[model samples]
Target: MTELVDIHSRTPKRRANEAMMAKIGKLIWALLLLSGFTRAATAGVLTGELDNPSGTLDDQFVYTLSIQGSFDGSPEFPKVDGLDVAVGGKSQNVSIINGKYSHEVQIQFILSPQKAGNFAIPPIKLTVDGKAMETLPLELLVSASGSPRLPPSASGRSGAGAGAGAGAGAQAQGDTPGLFIERKFSKNTAYVGEAIGVNVKVFSRIKVVGAQKDFRYPSVFQVKDKDNQKSNVEVVNGQEYNVTELESVIIANREGEFTIDPAILIARVAVQRRSRSRSFFDDLLGPTDLQEKRLRSESQTLKVLPLPTAGRRKDYSGLVGAFKLSGDLNPRESKVGDTLNLSLILEGQGSSSGMADPTLPFDTKLAKVYKDKADYHEELDAARGIDSTKTFRYAIVPERSGPLNLGQVTIQVFNPLIATYEDLKFDMGTVQIEASGAVTSAPLSSASTPTAGDTAPAADTALPKPEQKAVEVMAKDLVEPHSQSQLRGSDIITSSDWTNGGLALSLSLIGLVSTGVLAYRRKPETENARMQRANKAFKHSKKHLDFAQQCLRKQDLPQALKAAQTCFKDYTGAKFGVTSASVTLRDMESYLRSRSVSRETLHELREVWSALDQMIYAPPLGQNPTRGEELLTKSRRVLEQMERQCGRS
Candidate 1:
C-alpha cells in the first residue's frame, strides 16, 4: 500500500514540470524573433522622386529631384547620366514614428536639360547596409514656348487664390496654362512724368526642367525689356513665378497717351506634391507620382495720361511731388549797399537724391544778389518714399532805395492726387526799401592837409668843406680845450673840455653804426630759411592727409593708417623740430613744455599722435576714411594752433 501511494505522487509532479518547460520554451522563441526584427529595422534604406521637366531647348529651366530614406551605412547621391546636375545637401534627420525607431537621409539636386525632347531621369542609386538601392525613372516633357496651350482652371484671385487647394497642384506647374497675356494699371488717371504703377502677370501650368528657371514680373509704362529682372522660387501655397522691379523714371516725352511695352520671362521648372499615404515602404521608396509646373507670365500694357495744358501753366517750373514753398525777408527795411537776407524754403515728399537747387527770381534793378548758401535735409528710403527740404539763403544788396519786387517763384511738378500734372507759380511778395540807419553819429571830422601848391618851403643848400688851415687855427684857438691841450710825450695838458667833448662825440658815432648793422640783420629777407622750413612741414602734413582722404574713399583702412603715420611723422619733423625716427610721446611732451605751450594744446597734440599710432598698429576703427578724416581734421587744427604759438608768422 505505501509503494502505490509514492508512485501516484511522482506522476503528478512529473506532469507539472513538463507544463512549465513548454511555457519557458515559447517565451525564448518570442524574444529571439523580436531581436531579429529590430536588426532588420536598423538596416539602411533610400527613396526619391523627380518632378517633370518641360521647356524649349533655347529656354533655361530648373529640374529638381529629392530623396528621403534611412541608412545604417553612409549615403551618397548617384549622378544621373545625360543630365547636368548640381547637388546640394545630402544631410540626415532622425525621429521616432508611432514608437518605432526611424532615421532619414535626404539629398537634393538641380538639373538643366540641353536638348528639347522627351527625356527620362535615370534611377538614382544610394548605398545602405552595404547594399545599393535606387530611385525609379521619371518622365519629362519639353515643349516649345509660345505654343497654343489649354487654358488654366479658373480658381483663386490672381490665380494663386485664397488658400492651398486644387489650385496648389494646378498652379504649381504654372498659373497661366495658355499663351495669352494682359497688362494692368494701378490707376487710370495720372499726370505727365507721374510714376504709374503697373503689373504684367503671366500664368501657366507647364512642366519646366533645367539649370535656369522661368519668371513673371510687374509692368511699367514707358518701360521696355525688363525680362532680365525676373526671379523664380517656391512659396508657401505653390510658387511665386514673378520677377523683381521693372523701374522707369517717367519723363513725359509727349503730351498724349503713351503705352509701356510688355515685359516677359519664359522658363521651365519642376513641380511636386505630397503623397496620399506615407507607408514605411513609401517612405523608403518615395511616392509613386511626381507632378511639375512649366509656365510664363504674359506681356502686359499700361496707359499714362499726360499733364493738362489747358490750366494756367503760369509759375510751374517743373516741380513734381507735393511741396510747400515759402519766402521770408530778413530786416525788411534796409538801405542801399546794405545786406538783405532773402530765404526760400521748399519742403515736401521727394527723394533727397531728387531735390534740386531752387532758383529765386530777384529784381536785378533793385538788388544785386549773390548765391549765398543753401542747406538741405533729406531722408532717403528704399521703399515707401523720401522726404526732404531745400533752403536757399540769398545775400541781396539794394542798389537804390525804393519799393523792390522779388519776382514770383514758380515750380511745376506731377500731381499724383489730381492724376494730372500742374504748375505752381507765385509772384514776388513786395518789400519796401528804406534809407540806411546810422549805427554811429558823425561827430569829429579830421581836416585834410593842403597840397604842394598851398604850402611854402624855405630854400636849403649844402655847406662847403672847411679848409685844413682854418681847422688847425680853430683847434689851436680852442687851445686850452680839454683833449686839444692834453700832453702827448712833451706836450702839456690844458683844457679837459676838448678831451671830454671829443670822446663823447666818438661814442655816439660808434653807437649809430651798430644800430644800422642790427637793422640790416633783422630784414624779412633773412627769415626766408625759416619760412621754407615751415612750408615743408605744411606740405608734408598735407600729403599724408591727402593720401588718407584717397584711401578713405576707397575704404582701405590699413592703407589709410599707413598714410596717417606718414602725416604725423612729417608734422613732427616740421612743427616740433623732431624727426619721426626719434620722436616719442614723451619727447613731444618735453619739447612742447620747453616752448611754454599751453597744457590743453599739448594734450591735444599728444592725443592725436597716439590715436594715429594706435590706428596704424591696431584693428581698424570701423571704417577707414571716416575715422581717419576725423583724426586728420583734429591734427590740422592742433598743428595750426601750435605753429601760430611758435611764432611761425
Candidate 2:
C-alpha cells in the first residue's frame, strides 16, 4: 500500500493560529443563527395526533396531545374502539422566543392495540379554563406480529435528534437512528425567471430544543427566507418525532437544469438513558445528555425552461406570478405647490425582484412627479408561497390650479402559467388643487419642470411674502447723512454733531422698546400653542378615521384597519400624554374608569376594541372590504365617544 501523506501537519504556532480562527468562525456562526431566530418567531398553537398511526400487534405506539398555546388545565383522553390507552408520561418545555417567555406542555398516552384491526378514534374533547376545545378524530391500523405492517410510508430515514420510543427500537430494528432531514421541492421543473418554493423538514423522534441550519443551492435570484417556521409532532415507524420545517424561495434566474446541494442542520438533542428499571415516571424525570448532531438533507434537482419571446411585452419586467396592482391619491385635495402622496400598492405571489417600480405615466405638464421610495413587505403562506406587497409612494406637485389630472397608471407582469404578459391598469383620476396660499416674488417654474424643492412641501412662509417697502436709508444712511449741504452750509457742520448723536440714541431706544413689546406678546401665545395641541387630539383622530374610510372604499382592508387602529392609539396618546405604543386595552380601560366612565359603556367599548384587535392582528373573517368598513365605523364611534367625554371638559 502507498504511504499516506502527512502534508496536513503544521507548526505549533500555525496550529494555534488555526485553532483560534476556528473558534472565531464558530462564534460568528452562532450569532448568525441567533439573529435569524429572532426575526422568525411565531405565537403558540395547539395540536394533537397519534404518534404511530400504523403498527403491528407487538409494536409500540403513542398518542400525543400538545398545547403550545395558553391553557389552564390538562386534557383527559377518552376511550377509543379496539385500543387500550393509559397515561404514560408528560413533558414541559420552556424557552425564550424573541425575548418573550414561551411555555409548552405535551401529554403522551401509551397506546396498545387490542386485536389487530382498523380503528377510528373519535374526537377528544375537553374544557380548559371554561373554554371548550377538541382534537380531530384520528385513524389507526394494526396488523399481526408475524406480518409486520410496512409502516404507512417507507418507515425509516435517520439523521439527528430524538430516540426510539418504548419498543419502537424493536419495530424499526435495522434502521438508522437519530434526526432525519428531508427536502421537497414544490416543482421539479420551472420556466426561466419563475419562482419555486423550497421546503426542508427536520424530523426527529427525540426532543430537539435548538438547531442551526445552512442551505446551499444553485444560482438563483433574490432568495428570501420565510417570516416564520413552525414545529409539530409527526409519526414515523411506530415512533413519535417532532417535525420542524425550514422554508425559503428561490428564483430561477436563467433557463437550465440545476441541482441544489444538500442543506445542513446542527441540532442539540436530549438523549435519555434507558434502563430496565425505568418507569414512565422515571422517563418523565430521567437524566439525559445533550448531544450535538449534524444532519444533511437530500439534494434536489430542478429544470428551468426558457420563456417564449414571441408573447413578451415591452413593459414586462421579467416577473412571473399572479399579481395585481392598484393605486390611490392620499389627501386628494391639495394646494398648488403642496406635495400629494400618490400611493401604488402591488400585491400577489411572484418573484419580488423581478417586478421593478414601473415608471409613472402621469402628464408632467399638469403635475411634477418623482418617486419618493418603495417599501416591500410579505407574509408567508404555504399554499401560495408568499403574500407579497410592494408599495410605491410618489410625490406629486401640481403645477396648475383646478382639477389636475395625474392621468392613468399601469403595471405589466408576466404570468408563467399562461406564458403571457398581463397589463394591470389603474385609473389615477383627477385631484382638485387649490391655488397656493402664498405668492412668490420670482417667476414660477412650469409644471413640467418643478423647482428643486418641489419634491417636498414648500418651506416658504404659508402667510405669504412680506411687502418689500423701500426705506429712505440703507445701512450707510443709518448714520445721519454727512451733511449734503450746499458749499457754504455743507462746509460748516450743516447738522450739529450733538443732533446726530441724539438722533442715533433715540433710534436705539425705539428698537429696544419694540423688541420688549414682541417678547411680552409671546408669553400667552406660548400657552395657547400648548392648549391647541391638546385640543387637536380629537380632530387628528377624526382625520385618521377619514383616511381609513377612504382605504375601505378602495377595498384595501388591511390598510383601512391599520389606519382605524392608529386613530384610537393616537387619540389616547395625545390626550393622556402617554406613548402611543404603551396604550393597551387594559391601560385604556383603567384610564377611562378613572375618568368616571360608566361600567356599561366601558364593557361595550371593550368589545369594540377586541374586535378591532382581532381584525387587525388575526382576522378570522375573510379579507373583505365590508368587514373593514364596519371596523372603520366602530373605530370612528369610539373616537367620537372619547371626544364627547374628554373634549372641552
Candidate 3:
C-alpha cells in the first residue's frame, strides 16, 4: 500500500513537468517564425563594380551601382578623392518569380581618373524599407601608361552602356601618342560678307572604328558646304598616321572680334584586351574592346572689319560679288491697251545667293506697268564658287499710240576685291503702239509669257476668236390643262384654287427655311477648314523646330541653323499661302511689316537669320554645344510670336 501511493505522487509531478516543457517548445517555435518574417522584410542586396579595374590616368571607365529587392529611395554616392564621376545612364526592372516580387535598379557613372595612383571608390549607401544598405567598395589602379585591366562581367548586365560609351569613351583613354587634330584658317582678318576657308585635319596612328566630331563657331560667322576629303596615310612627327581633312567655307556677317571655339574629335579605337590564358586557342579567341580617344584643336580669334562707306552708291543692292545685267522687251510693236512683256536677267558669281532682285528704272511716260516677283536660280560652280541667275518679268500696258521708250534698267553691285561699286545698265530702246479701233468683250487668254530660259514660242498678243457651232432644234408637243377654269378669268372662286394657293405658299416657306439652314451649316464648315489649316501649319513648324533641337544636340551647327531658318520660312509660307522657297528675307520682312510686327521683333528675326546664314556660308572656329540650345530657344520664341500674329490675322 505504501509503494503504490509513492508511484502516484511521482506520476502527477511528471505530468506537470511534461506540460511545462510543451509550453516552452511552442514559444520557441513562435520566436523562430517571427525572426524569419523580419529577415524576409529586410532582404535586399547592394553591389558596385567597375568596367576596368586598372587603367591609365587619362583613361575613363564605367562604374556601376546595382540594387536588388525592394528599396525605399535612390542610392547616394559618396564623393571619391581621385575620381570624376558623371551619371551615364540608369535602368530598372521589376518581375514576379515563384509568387515573390523582385525589383532591381542599376545606375552607371562615367569615371575618369584624375591622377595616377591607387584609389578606393567609397561605398554607396541606400535605405531599403527604412533599413540601411551599403554597397561594396571598388578598387581602381591608374598608371601613367599601359592598357586598362578589365574586370569580370557582372550578372544581369546589359550592353547599352557600351553604346553610350562610344562617343565619350575617347576621353576615357589617356593622351594617345601620334593622334591629334589640327585646325587651320585661311586668314585671321576679313571684311564682313567676305568668304573665308577653314580646314580641319585629323591624324591617327591606331586603327579607328568610328569617329564623331563637334565643330562650332561664333554666331557672327556663317559656315558653308563642309567637305570631307578622302583619308590618306601620312608621316608626321616621326610617326605614320592616317590623316583626314575636312574643309568648310565661312563668312562673317557682323564686324567684331570673335573667338572660334576649339573643335573636338572623338575616335573609337579598336583595342586588344589582355588575356590571362597562355593556351593557343585562348590567344586566338581573345576579346577585342573599343576604347575612345579625344583630340581637340586650339581655339582661334578673328577680326572682322565693316565694309567701307566712302563712295557708296545710292542704288547699291547690298551685293558683294561680280555680276552682269541684261534686259529685253518682247514684241517691239503693240497696240494701245495691249499688254507687253519685259524681261531682265542678272547673272554672275560671289555671294549671289544673298542678292536681292534688281530695281528696274522705267520711264513713266512709256506705259502703265505691273511688276511680277523675280525668279532666282543658283548653282555651285567649282571655278567661281557660287553661280546664280535672277530673272525679273514685268507686264506693261501701252496708254498712248505713238513710239515710246521702255527706259533704262540700272543695277549696282559692290566689288569687294577692288573696294568699289560698279553700276550695270540695260537700255530697252523703244516700241510702237497703235490705238485700238474697236472694243471687244472677249477675255484675254490665260497663257504665261516666255521665261528667260524657255524655248517655247512667244504668246500671241491678242486672244483667239471662239468658233460658233450650230445645234439642231427639237420640237415638243403641248399638253392640255387639267382644269379649264384655271385658264379663265380670276373673278370665279373655286375650292381647287384655294388648295393650290395654300400648297404653293407652304412650299415657298419650306424652301426659304432650307436655304437658311444650308447657309448656317456652310459658315462653320468654312471656319473649321481654316482652323485645320492653322493647326497643320503649327504642327509643321514644331516638327522643324524639333529637328533643329536634335541637330543641336549632335553639335551640328550648320544643320541646326538650317532647320531653324526652315521652320520660320515654313510657318510664313503656310500663313501667307505662298511657297517657302519663293519667300526671301525681304519678302518675310515685308510680310511681317504688313502684319504690324514690332520693330524690335523684326530686328531679332533679322539677327537670327543673319546668324543662320553665316553658319550656312562659312565654317566657324570651334564647337559650342550651348549655341544650339540658345538658337532653339530663340527660334521657339520667334515661332510663337509668328503664330500669335497669324492667329490675329
Highest TM-score against the true fold, candidate:
3
CA displacement after TM-score superposition, residue 226 of candidate 2 (Å): 2.7
Candidate with more favorable, higher lDDT: 2 or 3: 3
lDDT of 2 by residue, 405-506 (tens): 767776767777677878888888878998887774555558645578866546673436568887766456454555445346435653488799889999
lDDT of each: 0.53, 0.66, 0.68
lDDT of 1: 0.53
Report how far residue 170 has shifted in candidate 1, in Å.
19
CA shift of 245, model 2, Å: 1.7
Model 3 error, position 117 (Å):
13
Model 3 spans with C-alpha error above 4 angstroms: 1-83, 87-182, 199-212, 223-248, 266-270, 273-287, 290-292, 337-339, 379-387, 434-649
True-vs-predicted CA distance for residue 604, candidate 2, Å:
63
TM for every model, in the order presented, reads 0.42, 0.41, 0.48
Span of 10 residues, lowest total lDDT, candidate 1: 164-173
| Candidate 1 residue 481 C-alpha distance from true site, Å | 39
Put the candidates in TM-score order, highest first.
Answer: 3, 1, 2
